[model samples]
Target: MPEVARVVPLPHEVDPQPQRAEVTALLEGGLIRVRLPDGREWDAAWLQAGGSTSIELAAHDWVIVLPPAGGHPAVVMGRIGPSARPPRRHACASRRPRC
Candidate 1:
């Protein structure tokens, strides 16, 4: 029998309630520096997808930042529109089996 490939869907829209931030700098160790709307800056980690999906972010990229849980750093949730460059693709993990 031939192997079947499963297709996972990407997030159709960004988080409705995520805090807006601008990528100030790109850092090492899968982290990026971001400046919040209030002018505060912090190094935040990218939220990992459940499977193998990864989102690529660059300097000056506008992204939605989610508040940190516990003592963890903030997570970059998704990107915003009106970007001059082509947006990167990302996938979200699903609990349902592939149909």
Candidate 2:
């Protein structure tokens, strides 16, 4: 496996604001995936509707991201599912906590 970071979402989780644009950017950037518990899979950019938790990032470890689009950072009400791989340097490096 080439090792990629995955961002998983939980069901019924509410996002303070639906960041469809940001998610599309990430998907177009080729850095995200949607992992379903039922074994279905999809690209991050494919996420359209709001309130979907069954998202996952495969290949490398992922860090929760809250983009500063509006004055308030986008919120994700889900967990980054457990990973069997080590955290990738590019995953958390060059990132700072939002003030």
Candidate 3:
């Protein structure tokens, strides 16, 4: 593949590449805060499908961060499988009852 030139969302040592990060917070400006593997936090832009049916990104969700390309800002590509939401519990089960 051809080498691509890009810039990170913020000034940091992390090279421009696809990386896994945990969503920490969602911003009002269509951006989100993510903590890198190095424990550094950065504000990044988000990209999602247009006509969405029901896909929401929440805190603690694992997402892919696509570093800026062609002068674009970093984007939260999308949430990965195994969401952060707790699994559904049964009322007759051991722990907490289902609401």
* Candidate number with greatest lDDT: 3
Q: Write the per-residue lDDT of candidate 1 for residues 10-34, one digit (tens) a residue.
A: 3445343568999988887867789
Instruction: Write candidate 3's Cα lDDT for 16-61 as tens digits.
Output: 6788999999988777889878897777876645533266778998
lDDT of 2 by residue, 1-99 (tens): 744634545334444342222122244454454333344333432322354434653444333343333233243333345644766688668899899
TM-score per candidate, in order? Answer: 0.56, 0.21, 0.56
lDDT comparison, 1 vs 3, better candidate: 3
Question: How far off is model 2, as Cα RMSD?
Answer: 16.0
Worst 10 residues of 1 by lDDT: 7-16
Quote the positional error of residue 14 for candidate 2 in Å.
16
Count of clashes, each model: 0, 11, 0
User: Could you give me the TM-score of model 2 versus the true structure?
Assistant: 0.21
Kindly report which residue pairs in candidate 1 clash with one another: none
Off by over 4 Å in 1: 1-17, 50-54, 82-99
Candidate 3 segments exceeding 4 Å error: 1-15, 50-53, 68-72, 82-99
